[model samples]
Target: MAGSSATGLATLLPGAAEAAQKGVLTGFDLARRQGFPMLRHGPFGLIANPTSVDATGVHIADILHETAGVPLAAMFGPEHGFRGSAQAGKSEARSRDARTGLPVFDIYAKSGDALTAIFRAAGIGCVVFDIQDVGVRFYTYISTLFDSLVACARLGYEMIVLDRPNPITGLDCAGPVMQPGYESFIGRAAIPIRHGMTVGELARLFNAAFVPALAGRPARLRVVGMQGWSRDMWYDRTGLIWVPPSPNMPSLETAIVYPGTCLFEGTTLSVGRGTTMPFAYLGGPEVDGAAWVAALRRRALPGCVFRETYFTPGFSRHAGETIMGLELIVTDRQAFAPIPTALTMLSDALRLAGKPFWSDGGRTFDLLAGDGDTRAMLERGVAPERIVAGWQPALDRFRARRSGYLLYS
Candidate 1:
């Protein structure tokens, strides 16, 4: 059944074979070429953000609004809001888009019946989702995707996902899968931390595997798959321009390390949120930069090097205070294992701190890691390699389960 569904999905993508012969073409680009037949289900609301733009840097909302016969009636913003004006854990208040004058709804941190009510209030027949995902499990965009799918499933609204590349190549599936009871917006479903799949592929997986259980039936979902994208190509290799998916995720470099370093958010350490480097920089007010660097270097983790550095973040965590730590530079992305690298860093930091490293009694860390076991093991001075090794069986199962949903070769 799954194989047939996969084949059906592949057939739905027009020009997919021809697209592979050319340059990378996003699902939105292909949909535009087809005159957006999806929009024929009129008065569709868009759930998008800054990253929802085309090859030419034009925002999809603007393009659809200008296109005659396209019923781009409403807009919805996720974590950072529609225009991306809000900071982390916050979203823009409900307002009208100045450009399109369309009503904008806030969907961040919202789920279940509340989310369904918002969709019902929009008076739209269908929902269009087109946000660029960085391919990490905890990134809120994917959470928004899951919640929106649940709401759509309940409301019987079809969701057309305009897919984009997983900025970090969709090849390596690493880190721990979220446990049953530890579900949060950061991880609504049980997938690995580094889920090596695109948004469209994930949409398919969610629709078939998870949504039926949550919404009592799968959402009506169609993924407009990308053309010319494969499992091994990274975002920089794609010709598309980089738009910061969120204020903190500034570049491809940041996206590369994000799957691991983002776990720092659960700790006392700063993930360099306000700094120019963001996830590339890790530090805290009390960290010993030289000692941390030496410890990391001793591990000699693959495909990366560390430089002792200091910086005063302009905003989140240690804001206006000079932090002592290191800048992680990935020398070879192919060999780099972000999850293990971060675990090593975390273990070393915990040893050096002489204090509790976790915030909120390590609950947040456990939530991000997808279980309390990881935190308990790290606290017990377990080796990062051993912790990573423990995850392999589960990771293998996840890879097998997700194989049918992969769109690229």
Candidate 2:
């Protein structure tokens, strides 16, 4: 009842309320207390996007160039372009940054010789990655960071990571580990679906795991961490700006539903792209929203609710056609786990359809879930609760292994 009196967390966990407010810190804020003084005269290339801003909305790249004279040699664009213009599955090629006046290279798809060439051409002594990650493994910004670190190692450049909050708390790691063969651009490493580690914490893990693969051999790594960040805090608690990392991820509300709804992307259901709502709505042309919501309501999944509705997406999957689906309302983010929520919905939806209700691609859910286990469980008529229970052992093992690399508790 101590934290609960003023914070209203009396029944909730001790730190639950504070954790909700503190999200990822902005790069400009990080620079003030971080080792930014040294970068004032150093040659540097910024690996960042529009989200790398100060608390008051000052862009980090502009701040570094105008004030510090760090010589912004090359601007490395992540999944989204330097200005956050590109879409999913594609990276913006070389383009002129209107604000920074620097050559923005596309590192979204660059690798091996191409990556080596980018650094060699820029000839900068240090490479700094300051992009924001949604704290989910499927979100690809962290993968871009990993690839850049690999490049820095190979090119013998000083790799300094400016720390940001994980947006999600770093305390909870959930979902199945990325098995060996399922690794793709979306998942470059064997981390959980919700990795819960900040980009800096992940950088520390990379230094330990792939020391041999680092380009220059040894990890020439340095991390400038935040002063007030804690492992218990989530994004909203950080008092940082919430810039949508991509087009589909419209808000933290949408992101709360994404971990599960995203698996629908590999299927025929419309995961609500191209419309203003984005991931907030999920439905397909053949879906019966009323029936689906009614069925899901019976399950009474914790911390979430479903609103039966009909929608038409402008593009992406079921474009321009009215479809019935369910809208996920996450009333309690702390108690809601998107992975389990999604699995339950997907299983229920499949069963309700009855006529083999999947889109043309059978078992495509396997790819999205990163293995056949989830799909097989769904197919074998296993409920969502059982499916989650099945993966607990693997998840536990991964947590034990990842414990060594954890920078924060």
Candidate 3:
């Protein structure tokens, strides 16, 4: 309502670039095409979710089970359950997948010795990880990968990663690095918030940087990379079907803003969890929706626009309460910086809403932000630019460390 109030949001978005839907085959697809050669070493367990599928929508566990020689020893599910029926911080109960008839074990928030026990109980010599990640540190799937890597390394299990695209293009990395002592299920290893690496690349990074500390060694790792996918390619460009990795993550647009808006979850505000546009909408009952929109709009943040809106969440945060906020309209994917954008909105909301902008004891925000610096910085009336600038040193160091693990250019 401030910056370009006279113009519609569509006017701020970038023009159509190229409609190149180049056929991109994910690691699972390639592995399936090649007759699941990696699993030939066999009787392997799979750590997967509903997101682990091919272009035709066939689940990985089902494919392996039907394969002639590849033994689908067991199945493991991460957060949101193996079938993806659960919600945030919750997972599906241990039950048999009705379709594949395979027993699904819960590995949601497990790690180290606990995960090792799961590995042992599975009675498999190898473990395969295939889950779609939205290219952020707090996404938990990567943490699942890291914990599984630690367990595999210690247990001497052959680990294979069926690499997937980082729905958000892998070309850019942003946000603050997680500091020491803030480790939790949300932010486990020390990495930047919006880490631009696929599961395969992250596996390499985890194995090289962290597994040694946790397991005294790195697991025997093999990553099956995606064919025809480059660092610059986003999900829309990859020609892969969009599957909601979790209930709230409905589309590629959700993944785009997630690394930034997800920080709102640390605050008392609802990050559109119960609404249809989760991560794309942000508001609280106390938030002055028009003021928040106008403040954000005045900043003229690149690649996005703020439009005033309202919604009643079915659950989470201000459940059953009609709350007002702004719906994010991302216009230019290449130019959009989600973490910085979200921080700007957050600082504005905190300034406008005052005491109402609190969270679940602030520990969740600290963990999500990697440390308490961001929250403290915002509370101290620091500008968003300065707060973002503070992250560059740590972000640069993380980028350097992660470069060695990158699989594609």
> Who wins the lDDT comparison?
1
Off by over 4 Å in 3: 1-22
| Local lDDT at 110 for model 1 | 94
Model 1: lDDT of residue 60: 95
- Of 2 and 3, the candidate ahead on TM-score is 3
Q: Where does candidate 2 stray beyond 4 Å? A: 1-28, 38-41, 211-218, 354-364
Q: Candidate 1 on 162-264: residue-level lDDT in tens?
A: 9899989989999999999999988999999999999998988888888888888888788887888878999998888999999988899999999999898
lDDT score for candidate 3 against the true structure: 0.84
What's model 3's lDDT at 368? 91
lDDT of 3 at 347: 89
Cα RMSD to the true fold for all candidates: 1.8, 7.0, 8.9
Candidate number that wins on TM-score, 1 or 3: 1
Most accurate candidate by TM-score? 1
Q: How many clashing pairs per prediction, in order? A: 0, 15, 0
- Candidate 3 residues 1-409, lDDT tens each? 1021111111111111222343777788767766777789767889998888888788878878888899887889899999888888999877888877877889999997888998898889999999999999999898889899889889888888888888898888798899999999888888988888888888877787788888887788878777777788889888888899999999999999999999998888888887899988889866799998998888999999999998887778988888888899999988999999999998889889857476867888889999989999998999999999999998888888887777676
Structural similarity to truth (TM-score) of each candidate: 0.97, 0.88, 0.93
TM-score of 1: 0.97
Q: Which of the predicted structures, 1 or 2, would earn the higher lDDT when compared with the native? A: 1
Q: How far out, in Å, is residue 289 in model 1?
A: 1.3
